[model samples]
Target: MRPQQVIDGDFTYWLGDMYALLGEKETALRWLRRTDEISNHNYPWFERDKNWNNLRSDSEYQRILADFQRHWERYREEFGDG
Candidate 1:
């Protein structure tokens, strides 16, 4: 029997980065948004990731930063700053 597939948010996020690297911004954003939703905005890979460097100048990238800040605030409220 074949094992069931588990679509991880992290994996999707990485796929998004790959899409971005390949110059598919819309598709990359789509996947990245899904990743963010699945992770509830707490995806750890975003903390110090370098792959997103290509998107640094995009408005969407700024929005992602804002999302990250919001996630950090929520985390602090829920678990206290670590």
Candidate 2:
């Protein structure tokens, strides 16, 4: 059976984490990006998240981090720091 849809912030975060662990950096980033868009509570997790450990040294990962930082800054300005 297909997995049930996840409609919560934490579930999206964990799904991103799972994808990262599975070595799917692009997919993981996509899900994590969605979590960022949907939930302010998930912002702090990215800095020290273990799921992204493997990607730490990758150039693509650095780009993703830069993009995330930009998005986060914009989010803070628009939403008033959550």
Candidate 3:
């Protein structure tokens, strides 16, 4: 039963990335934000993913990137680079 709570993070991330590649900025952003909340995509992963390239100059995408960085900082403070 405990495993029922686990989510397929990769799938969500895929949806976000796919939407981004399709040029659906708003939809991609929404899914990407949800992916971040559920899976916590790392900076390296974000950087190397070309799917999000279309959003590089987008304000909302930048904001999401900032939020992801903040989460990483908090994680580091608590876990010390686990």
Top-scoring candidate (lDDT): 3
Question: Candidate 1: deviation at residue 31, Å?
Answer: 1.0
Candidate ranking under lDDT, highest first, comes to 3, 2, 1
Write model 2 residue lDDT over 1-82, tens digit each, in one string.
1123455768777887898999998777677666655643444567688778987887866665666677777778999955
Choose the strongest candidate by TM-score: 3
Model 1 Cα lDDT, one tens digit per residue, 1-82: 1112325776777787888888888777777776666654653557556777777788886687678668868888999867
Using TM-score as the yardstick, the better of models 2 and 3 is 3
TM per candidate comes to: 0.72, 0.58, 0.77
Q: Which stretches of candidate 2 lie over 4 Å from their true place?
A: 1-6, 58-82
Cα error of candidate 3 at position 43, Å: 2.8
**Cα lDDT of model 3 by residue, 12-66, tens digit:** 6787798899999887887777767785668667767888988999998998888
The clash numbers for all candidates, in the given order, read 0, 0, 0
The C-alpha stretches of model 3 lying farther than 4 A from their native spots are 1-7
| 44: Cα error in model 1, Å | 6.3
Local distance difference test, candidate 2: 0.70
- What are the Cα lDDT values of the candidates? 0.69, 0.70, 0.77
